[model samples]
Target: MAATIEMPATRRPIVVAPMAGGPSTPDLVVAAGEAGALGMLAAGYKRPADLIAEIADVRERFTGPFGVNLFVPADASCAPERVDSDSAATGVADAEGRDRADRVAVEAFRDLLVQAAPDVHVPTPDWHDRDHYEDKLDIVEAARVAVVSFTFGCPQPHVVERLHEAGICVLVTVTTEEEAHTAVAAGADALVVQGYEAGGHRGTHRVTDAPNQLDHLALLPMMTDVGVPLIAAGGITTAGDTRRALGAGAVAVQAGTTFLLADEAGTTAATRMGLTDPRLGSCVTRAFSGRPARGLRNGFVDRFDALAPAVYPAVDQLTKPLRARAAQRGDIDGVSIWAGAGWRAAREAPAADIVDSLTP
Candidate 1:
């Protein structure tokens, strides 16, 4: 059955992009509501208990509508122990990328391991996609979050059905028309049409497929009547861009770069600094997490992935300590500063101040 929600014609029209790892927080969510935009708290990379806390926090602060983005875990059935202490797990490097390394990367990784005690064995990441989905769903529904979204791809039918049953609005991020159709068929309440120029990770369902670079303007009408509300994302860096998206058929627009430097954002100083500097122009690479994500081009992405395996949370885990250390030493060259092409438009200010750029 098709799902439905009680959206008004004059609903505040902007949706905040959920950035993981500190950038998207409860404060950010409240600011989105305060600014008359819908904020989405990132549930990615956080434990279920932690996500619950954040949902509660946002509920306490904002009575208005908001969304929570879930990183739908993939169904790869590989054993997590395969890469544990596996030295072959060493990341592969590239020729042009080797020169980009700053001195602090490896040392930073080493020091953090000493403290976090990431197993001396270094097992591949223990991935449980369904577990994360179910646990998070319980929290979002309990909190009665107004909106819920999925990334990397839409979920199975049953999963989508459950969210709808809870009276929550669900949106899925898609990079292509195929995914757009797939999401609608699976019962998504809306679609977040992510374009190529957008930054951070591309939400292509099949990890191996080359990402579609169709800009939002071109892709928008191409979707033609997807039979659901369209919430456009990717590459929207300014108010003009937002207007264009809605003009092209989007019910609302979403953006990520502006939050890169928001005071409430958990972005590290290294990232905040690099994103603003022109010398650190961004590039997409599958190095750090074995997925093609756009970030401030760095030595780490340049060198690795020459032989980096396609394993995900595994690759993500192997490099966590390395990234943590580099960030600690203020090494922007080695850290991943995921930003959209609009990093140039990002402002270092409060979240409420940042979303004002997108306010209608």
Candidate 2:
């Protein structure tokens, strides 16, 4: 285990959750640090070189402690079975049949996308892509930032050992008590206790499992015995929310939706409009990413939520171009506007001011 390094939350008790796909930026990270809070750079969708550049940028501008968050790729065993040539030739009605069914579902969804967004270029699903997991691991280890966090699954014990060897603290996001225990057994230094109310992905270990609808406050106390530092996440927006989480035994509180409107955030105009629009409500759906995430309800979600498969990066990749085009056109009905349950409280401000407001 790493020699009991101090958690950044021990200093300020406020952490900016790493919002991947644009909202998290170097300026946001610096602003969080400037306000005596910890900010994390999201590494989910970036290339290793891009992650390296972002790390260098943050280091150059802000000397205070920060962190990088990575998505642990889903294991091959969890993936849908691939259709083999023999199976296709034989027309087998067992495992191969199931694989074929899965493929059909994905293709049907693609057809729907093509029909709805004729101008957008939808690509074929990359079933085997691991989101460059190995390369990003190397980059993060070399960077030796103050902290590193993992979502989607717990890192293997050896991976944790290696990060500890490099003098880095490791945190894993977990949505349940069982997950918290698993992460601790895997040598995670702390657990980011994510509730169903959290914006973006649910951080469940298995891609296919539906995340439980436990609110962060209701879930935090259940994890108090896990013997690691606890960071509360999910819909935390106000000073009252922060204090309640800390009182529930969280060493800190991590907020994502609250910072969506920050000046430094890379949130698109469509997402901004969705956040403030009273007509747009929020719900958890797999329509956009194939993994259950909470975002503003829109026409795309209404059209595709029930049809989206459980395959993640595959579904995420398939919808990427369409979402980009939607954002470019500033069409709120077509983009994923991720926000927490307390999204109504979000307001435009400097990240430092936002951090200060959330600080209890």
Candidate 3:
């Protein structure tokens, strides 16, 4: 028998989205939990030891309920290798040669990067980055967080069972109704219905699938039959947006961009500036990372979006050094300023205050 994991009682219908890569801090999660809402710790791009330390820190300061978010590893089997005598490295090959095309596209983009910014030396892409999927899961299971949420893809049944056995409720993020159904079938206790307006990466399961750009309200009606607690995410910055989601049948709302400017967030100066820049606009681009993510438009994206391939963490790894150099110099154009459509409405305040404002 699977041990029953009880859901945390959150008084507020608000959830702090796990803005991985820096914004998700222990203080931020603690503040949100203290404010009667559920906060999430992002385990993406984190070392297992570091994440365990953070779990310990958050547990010590805040006894209330919180969650941990993990990125499900991309299926490497999707890309089969074939010899391309003309290519510089082993390239992916499809029956129709689509994989070879992707490799060519990525190489072209790489050349563009070199020419665009000669001073910044980019690192060799790490093809093996699964974001430490299994190790992170082990840490989460051992820590026994109140909730364990997955993004990028749905977890296998055994993974869900293991988490359930450890007394943790599982939540899967979905961008389409099909994904919602898949999550429900996979035994997710809840669904994070992320719409196209969300900041950062679109949680579409397959890298090849173009994200459905539906709004939360529009997608809500499509997912009502999934029969699980629904958490609406994306473009939810103001109280009105929160009200709309709840009225549309969501049990809770998750907002990330609203908290980007929060005192507790580790938002970079470049990101902060881009978020507030009047001329900057948000758009979906795979320039920074191979996967499609929404961010404030800048020179780098303008130059590389067309050239970028559909590859994910590989492209992400390729751009790491360049982004880091840009960040060090406070150059907004070169780094990713991940923001949602409502970025202009973001305010600088405490995470608790943001939760309070969003709470009805």
Candidate with top lDDT is 2
TM-score per candidate = 0.84, 0.92, 0.92
Instruction: Enumerate clash totals for all models, in the order shown.
Output: 7, 0, 0
lDDT assessment of candidate 1? 0.74
Greater TM-score among 1 and 3 belongs to: 3
Candidate 1 deviant stretches above 4 angstroms: 6-11, 76-123, 127-131
Off by over 4 Å in 2: 1-4, 76-101
- The TM-score measured for candidate 1 stands at 0.84
Candidate closer to the true structure by lDDT (higher is better), 2 or 3 = 2
Ranking by lDDT: 2, 3, 1
Model 3 residue runs over 4 Å out of place are: 1-6, 76-101
Mark the 10 consecutive residues where model 3 has the least summed lDDT.
76-85
Residues 42-143, model 2: lDDT tens digits? 999899899999999999998889999999886612222334556655645655565677678788888888888787889988767898988988998998
User: Positional deviation of 208 in candidate 3, in angstroms?
Assistant: 1.6
> Model 3 residue 192 lDDT?
93
